[model samples]
Target: MNFANRIRRAGIRVPPPARLVAGLALLALTGSLLLMLPGIGTARPLRLNEAVFTAVSALSVTGLTVIAPGRDLTVFGQIVLLALIQVGGVGFMVLAVLVYRLIGRQMSLEDRMALRDSLGLLSLTEIVVLTRRVFKVVLLIELIGAILLWLHWRTLLPLSEWDAMRYALFHAVSAFCNAGFDLFTGLPQFPDGVPNDGVTLTIFAILIVIGGLGIPVVADLINWPRSRTLSLHTRLTLFIVLWLNLTGALSMFVAETLTAGTLHAAPVGQRFGLSLFQVISARTAGFAGFPNLEALSPGAHLTLIGLMFVGSAPASMGGGITTGTFLVMLISMWSYVRGFPAARAMGRTISQETVRRAGAVLTVSLVVVITATYLIAISHSDIAFLEALFEVVSAFATCGLSLGITGDLTLFGQVVIMLVMFWGRLGALTIVAALAMPRRKTLVNYPDAQILIG
Candidate 1:
């Protein structure tokens, strides 16, 4: 039997979750091996830990790095990182399906299922359509972002027009992928200086938001006229995203103003803008113009930790427990408090299965984050507990923002964070499912037991 027939006959199927895990593992391992090569960059061959860490970050699109992007890596290295970002952001399995379609090959049922899971589609047909639409939207958004950035950066870099174009394209793709990789050696600001400019910051913010919105919601908005209604997923995603943005912005603004002694004494407008940008970026976007994490007030740091924990929406390039999962938990809590039979949102009742899945995801995420934070603390006692916790959340959320301590981590700590990033991107559910064995169900019902609750 051929490959397809063999895949069918094994009684073992590659579910979407399995495919995603396998694809990401393969990509990450391959990228790590490539980065280990000598002479690939002007800098020395990355240490094994660094290589693996970078690979995991790129494959997870987390953007956490021990070395600066433009300065440490050569053009070739940057290209490899960029390719990994694109693959990781779009998902390797979805890209395979797209390639199959482009070559006039029909997707198998298994393939369709994989695509559906990767894109969080409810049906195989919808998955196929979503794949096409996602490609178009990503390309259009990235292209537009690149043009705008290029216009802003034309005279800033001491390079030819062609070189400036390349920089613009690179940063644009990085932002839209939520990769957080930048060609600039330091901060992401105007060409002339480190001063935060409205044009650059606004463009980057737009790119990050578009990338984090999740493709399904974008597709719904694009097709709104004909559909006339958004799906439950889209509605929930929008609600959570908007609410988080508003609250996060306000909280950060307040914290920054109250703690202004620790913050650089900037104009109120600039401080507010920085607070907003950092708040949004903390939610899995990973773009940081400033590296002064140590300078932020305790309150601002705590606020960021909360934002990173919540992270981005489901099926988006970015990761975390996900906004949807958090929203589900919140709704479930509200329902329990109100004595409702089931959780509901936006006039629609959420299924018990979804609620259960959300709980499982959140539980596993918490376990991983807490456990990893503890491990890192054991390995690097010099780092503060709060900073370690922040780093753990950042890694697990695939939000690369650090408390100025990532580079100071030991090998064991780096490895732990790498695993966290991988788990975050692939999702706790996908990882758990991949390891679980398939068992045939028996026609038996177990006795129910009630437990006492607090």
Candidate 2:
């Protein structure tokens, strides 16, 4: 038989999830190669490991880096990073589909299927229309944010007009992508590590919040009147997002009330602002208003660790197990304690499959974080356990916040970090789906049994 007929006879086919993993892998590889070019970095070409780490970080929109892009890379390299953030934040499938539509090419059956799978759409109907709408909404929000930032920053900083505009657009996109990369520390006229100006913080806060809300939630918001109803996904995403933000800010404020060289030294208004910014950044955007992260109290660090673990909403640029997964698990526990057979929220029952999948995602993610933490600990034995844990969680959650050891790690530790960033971006479910064999239904049905459980 020919190759196609032989494969058909053997019953082999690649699933959409697998295709996503493959596509991302190819993109990351290409990004690394491009970064290694001589024109991108300092006098010398970028090293392989450093280039790979940056590529994965950018494509994942994670914002972690070994080499400082600002001091170590030329403006051209930074622009490439921005482009990666844009494409990665919107997702590979969305960009591919857009290119196809712009060229007046019809989407193939497989393309439609992959787009549906990647975008987390409820149905395949009107996928193209939805894609365009999402793209437009994202661009509109980003453009407006960039303009607002430029207007505010132009008079505050002493940089040239073009330079100030560059910072504005760079940070606006970085914040919107929840990719914590910044030009503040590396650029001229800002000897301080990050911009502490209130307007800047406020703008970043807004962008990070909107970006972390995920595309589906944004669409629900745009079509509110016509739809006249919200999906359970949107409802839970919003409720959890608000709760996490509030709780994170309050907990950090209280925890660092007396700590020195950090929140304690700041004015009351600025203290709250810093707390708000840190919590929001920890929510998945890792920009720093307070640069000396090592100065925070252990309690404050613990609070941040919890927030980072919870992470942002599903289908957003931010990572971790996601707030949706965390809330589902919490609700499931509450229902069980109240003696309910099923978890119910807003007078609706959560399906068993959701609970099961949430459990799997959480469990797999825990294993990933713990395993990576162990590797980082052994690799960097001189660092504190909490610091190592913090770095690993930051990388695995794709939050990009660090305890200041990102550059100090050895090559092996850096590789471990890159792997965690890649893992965090693809996520537990996608990774599992990509690896697991497809199931084939059997003729016979198995009997069900009950067993004692925790």
Candidate 3:
């Protein structure tokens, strides 16, 4: 038999989840090797671990890094990093399907399923339409952002026109992709290592917020003008996202103000501005308004951690338990306590399967974070428990905010962080489901039994 028939005879099949994980892993490996190639690094060749870590971070769109990208990598290397960020932010399968459509090639059933899973859609009905929409929308937003940033930065920063354009494009993509690769470090104007200017920070925040709103939600929003109605999912996602951003900004401002910490040194209005930017950044964008995160009070740290843990919306350029999952768990718990039979939101009852899956995701994520924290704490004995936990949560959430401990991680600790980043990117439920064996339905039904109460 030929290759295809031979594989069919052998009953070889890779499930969609396996394909996703495998595809991303393969891309990461290729990226790492590319990063290690000559001319990719500035002075000397990059070490294996550094290459691997950077590659994974880029592909996962996680901003944690052992080495500084702008300082250590050449222009070619930065381009590769930018490409990975774009691909990772918009699912690779999305771009693949778009290409296939452009080439007038038909996609197989397997391709459709993979795309569906990648976009986190429940149905495959609008796979092609959504793919095209995502590509067009992403590019348009990035283009507008780049133009605005270029116009503003050219006047403000001391750089050549070409350098200004390049920086604008890079920051625009990074912000929209929620990839926190920045070249402003060590700059004379940006002593804080990030943009403190109102216009630049506002542009970055807007891009980050839109990017994290999820592809499906964006599509729904764009179509809402014509349809004149919003789906329950879109409504709930918007509400919760707005609520979280406001709450996080307010809480961080209060905490830091109370302790006279990082925000205390800033002007009254500027303190809230810093807090708002960092709060927005905490949701999977790693941009910091100030250089020293360690100077923040314990309350501020906790607020950031909580925001990171409950990241952006589902199927967005972010990683965490996700807003949908977090909201589901909260609603489920509140319903149970109120003696309600069903979890309700926005006048709709969420299915039991969704509630169960949310619980599973939360449990698995907690286990991963707690276990990783324990390992990092033990492996890097010099790191304090809170710092260790922050690092673990940041990795697991793929938020990339650090207390200056990323470079200090030992090999073992780095490995743990890498695995957590991978897990966060692929999602706990996706990985668990992919690794599970095929399920066989049983005709027999067992009688319901009482379980112990919490």
Measured on C-alpha atoms, candidate 2 has an lDDT of 0.85
Number of the top-ranking candidate, with TM-score as the measure: 3
**Best to worst by lDDT, what's the order?**
3, 2, 1
Q: Which tens-of-lDDT digit does each residue in 1-454 have in candidate 3?
A: 6463565578888788988998899899998999899998898879999999988887788889998877788888888889988988898898888788888988778878988887788788967887898789899999999999999999998878998898899889989988887877644655677667899999999999999988889888888899999888889899999899889999999999999897787888898888988988898888887779998999999999999999889988898999999999988988889998999877799999999999999999999989999999878889999899988888887778899899999888889999998998889877997899999999999999999987
| Model 3 stretches astray by more than 4 angstroms | 1-10, 186-190
CA shift of 437, model 3, Å: 0.5
lDDT of each: 0.82, 0.85, 0.87
- Which pairs in model 1 have colliding backbones? none
lDDT of 2 by residue, 389-432 (tens): 99989888788899888889999999898888888877888889
User: Candidate 1 on 250-291: residue-level lDDT in tens?
Assistant: 787787677663444777777777778888788977877454
Q: How big is the positional error of residue 396 in model 3, measured in Å on the Cα after superposition? A: 1.3
Worst 10-residue stretch by lDDT in candidate 1? 187-196
TM-score of each: 0.94, 0.95, 0.96
Q: Report, for all candidates in order, the number of backbone clashes.
A: 0, 0, 0
Superposed by TM-score, candidate 1 places the C-alpha of residue 20 at a distance from the truth, in angstroms, of 1.5
